[model samples]
Target chain A: MTVSELAQLDDFEAVALPEADREIDGAYSGDLLSWVMGRARAGNAWITIMSNINVVAVASLADTACVILAEGVIPDEEFTATAQARQVNVLRSGKPAYEISLILGSVL
Target chain B: MSDALSFHYDVDGESFSSAGQASAGVKKNLRQLGIDPEIIRKVSIAMYEGEINMVIHAGGGEADITVEDNCIVIVLTDRGPGIADIDKAMEEGYSTARDNIRALGFGAGMGLPNMKRYTDEMNISSVVGEGTTITMKVFF
Candidate 1:
C-alpha cells in the first residue's frame, strides 16, 4: 500500500506526508536510531516512539516509506518541519509499536 | 588522485539534533554525483553512525569524505576523551553513553559495529586522553 493509503487508516494519522505515494514494502519496528538505520529496509514503514530531529534524519537515510510514531507520540514543531524539509513521510498512531506493526502487516 | 573529489565538514557537538547534518549533506552530494543508491546508502549509514558517535562520545568531530574512482573514503577525527579500548567499543551493546542519550533513541552501542558492517574497510586509532581517528572506505 502507498503511504497515503496507510494514512487513511483509522489508527494512523498523517503528520508529514511529503512522500505520500511511496509504497510500503515492509515494516520495521525499532526505537534505537542506529539499529533502525542499519536494519530498516528501504521502503519499510519504520515504527517508533522516537520523536526527535535525528528520527527525521534516519528516516531519510533509510528511505523508509513512512515513520509511524506509535503510542500517539507526536514530534515537536522542529521535527515536523525537518521531516517536511527532508521530504520524509511521517504518520502518527495511537497504538503501541507492536500493534502498529501488526496493523501494517495486515495491510502491507 | 587528481580526479578524486573531497568534502569536509566540522561536526557540531553542542546539539544532538544537528548530529546527522554532515551525513545528510554527504548523502546529497553523493546523489548529485550520480552514485548508485546502494552505495550511497552504505556510505550515508556508516557516516551517520560515525557522526552520532562523535556527538555522543567525542563531543563533536571532523568528517572528511573522499570519493575516488573505485571507492569512497570517510575519515572522522575527534579530540574528545578517547576510547580506552577499541575492541570493547566495537562490541555491540557496550556503549558508555549516558541514559539521557539512550532516551533519545541512541546509545545502544551498535555504532562502530554498524559502521564496520556497512563499509568495505575500517581502521581506528586512539589514545586515552588525546583523541580518536576512524577511517572507513566503501567500494562501489
Candidate 2:
C-alpha cells in the first residue's frame, strides 16, 4: 500500500506527508532508533511511541515508509514540522502500537 | 563528480532530538550527487549511528563527510568522556549511556557495532579524559 492509503485508514491521522510516494512492503515495531535503523527493511511502517525529531531521522535512514506514532503519542509542533520538512510520512493513531500493527498487517 | 566533495556540521548535544541532523543533511547531499541508494543508505546509517554516539557519549561533536570517487569517509570528533575500553564498547549491547538516554530509546550499545557493520572500514582513537575520534569509510 502507499503511505497515503495507510494514513487514510480507520482511526489513523496523517501528521505529515512524505516528499514522494513509496511502496510499503512490511512493518516493524521498535523504539530503539539504532536497532531499528539496522534491522527495519526499506519500505516498512515503523510503529513506535517515539515522537522526537530524531525519530524522523531514523525513519528516513531505515527508509521506513512512514512513522506511526501510536498510543496517542503526538509529537511536539517542532517535531511534526521537522517530519514534514524532512519529507518523512508521519501518522498518529489513538490506538496503541500492537493494534496499529495488526491493522497494517491486514492492509499490507 | 570526479572531484571529491566534503560537508561538515557541528552536532548539538543539548537535544537528543537534534542528533541526526548531520546525517540527514549528508544523505541529502549524497542523493543529489547521484550515489547509489544502497551505498547512500550505508553511509547515512553509519554516520547517523556515530552522530547518536557523539551526543549520548560525548556532549556533541564535529561530523565530516568527504566523498571520493571510490569511497566516502566519515569522521566524528568529540571532547567528552572518551571510551575506556574500545574492545568492550565495540561489542554490541555494551553501552554506558545514562539511564535517561535509555528512556529516550537509545544507549543500546549498538552504536559502534552498527557503524562498523555499515561501513567498509572503521578506526577509533580515544584518550580517556580528552576525547575520541572515529573515522569510517564506505567504498562505493
Candidate 3:
C-alpha cells in the first residue's frame, strides 16, 4: 500500500504529504526506539509519535518505506528537510499513534 | 580476512536523540556495498539496539563493524555501570533505565534480547561498575 492507499483506508487525514511516491509493503507501530529498530521490517511504513530527528536515522537504518508522524505535531524543519533529501516519505496524521496503529491493523 | 572492510564508530551517550547515527551510517554503507536487504536490516537493527543501550545505560561506547565474506561482526564496548546480572538483563521486559529514559520512548528492556535475536551469535563481557563489551555476529 502506498501512502495514498493508507490515506484512503480510513478517516486518517492526509496531513503531511498528499501521496507517497514509494510503495509500502508492511506496517509497524511502536514508541520504543530500540524495539522498533529491532522489529520494524524493511519496506514497511512506520507509525510513531516521536518527533526527534534521530527518528529519521532509525527509519533510514530500518529501511522503512515511509514514516507517518501519527500525532498531530510538527517536527523541526531540519527533520522534514533531511527526510525530503533522502526521499523518505514522511507524513503526519491528526490522530494519536495508537489510533493510527489500530486503523492500520484493520486496513493493512 | 584482512581484506574485509571495517568501520569504527564512537557512540555519543550525551544526546539521546542522536543515538542511532552510527547504525544509520553502517546501514548506508552496507547498502552501498550491495549487502542483502535482510542482512543489512538485521545488522542495522542489532547495532542500533546496542547503540541505544550504550547511551541509555552506559554513558556512551564504541562500536566496530567488520564486513567479511560470509559474516558481519559488531562489537560494542562501553564504560559505565556494568550489568550486575547478565541473565536478568537478557530477559525480556527487564530494564534498569530511569523513568526519563522511558519517556523518550525507550527503556523497554528489549535492547539486549533484540540484539541477540538479530545476530547469529552474541557474547557479553561485563564488569559491574567498570564496563561492558558485547560482540554480535550475523552470518550472511
Candidate 4:
C-alpha cells in the first residue's frame, strides 16, 4: 500500500505527507532511533512513538516510506516543519505500536 | 588524497535536535554524486551514529568526510571527556549517556556497535582527559 492509502485508514491521521504516494513494502516497530536507523527497510512504514526531530533525520537516512507515530504521539511544530522540509512522511495514530504494526501487516 | 572530495562540519552539541544535520548533508552530497544507494546508506548510518555520540557523550565535535577512489572515510574528533575503557564502550549494551538522553530515544548502548556494523573498517584512539578520535571507512 502507498503512504497516501495508509493515511486514509481510520486508525491513522496524516501529520506530514511530503511523500504520500511512496509505496510501503513493510513495517518496522522500534523506539530506539539508532536501532530503527540500521534495521528498518527503505520502504517500511516505521512505527514509533518518538516525536523528536531526530525521528525525521532517522526516517530520511533510512529512507523509510513513512513514520507512523503510534500511541497518539504528536510532534511539535519544529518536527513537523523539519519532516516536511526533509520530505519525510509522518502519520499519527491513537493505537499502540503493536496494533499499528498489525494493521500495516494486514494491508502490506 | 589530492583528487578526493572532502567535507567538514563542526557538530554543535548544545542541541539534540540538530545532531544529525551533518549526516543529512553528507547523505545529500553522496546522493548527488550518484554513489550506490547501499553504500550511501552504510556511510550515512555510520556517520549519523558517530554524530549522535559526539553530542551525547562529548560536548561537541568535528566530522570530516573524504570520498576517495576506493572508499569513503569519516573522521570524528571530540574534545570532551574521553572514553576510559574502549572495550567497555564498544560493548553493545554499555553507554554513559545520561537519563535525559535515554528519554530522547538514544543512549541505548548501540552507537559504537552500530557504527562498526555499517562500516568496513573502524578505529578509535583516545585519552581520558584529552579527547577521542574515531576513523571509519566504507569501501565502494
| Candidate 2 structure, TM-score to reference | 0.93
Candidate that beats the other on lDDT, 2 or 3, i.e. the better one:
2
RMSD of each: 0.9, 1.8, 2.6, 1.0
Model 3: which residue pairs collide? none
Docking class of 4: high
| Candidate 2 chain A, run of 10 with poorest lDDT | A16-25
In angstroms, how far off is B115's CA in candidate 3?
0.3
CA lDDT scores, all candidates in order = 0.92, 0.88, 0.84, 0.92
CAPRI-wise, candidate 1 is high
**Candidate 1 clashes between residue pairs 3 or more apart in a chain or in different chains:** none
Candidate 3 is graded, for docking, as: medium
Per-residue lDDT of model 2, residues B15-104, tens digit only = 787788898899999999899998988999998898888888788999998998899999999999898999999998999888988888
Q: Give TM-scores for every candidate, taking all chains together and pairing residue i with residue i.
A: 0.98, 0.93, 0.88, 0.97
lDDT of 4 at B31: 94
- CA-based DockQ, model 3: 0.66
- Candidate 1 lDDT, B1-140, residue by residue in tens: 89899999999988888888999999999999999988988999999999998998888999999999899999999998999989999998899999999999999999999999999999999998989999999998
Worst 10 residues of 1 chain A by lDDT: A98-107
Tell me the tens digit of each residue's lDDT in model 2 across A3-43. 88877778799888854377788999999877898788888
Q: What is the interface RMSD of candidate 2, in Å?
A: 1.1
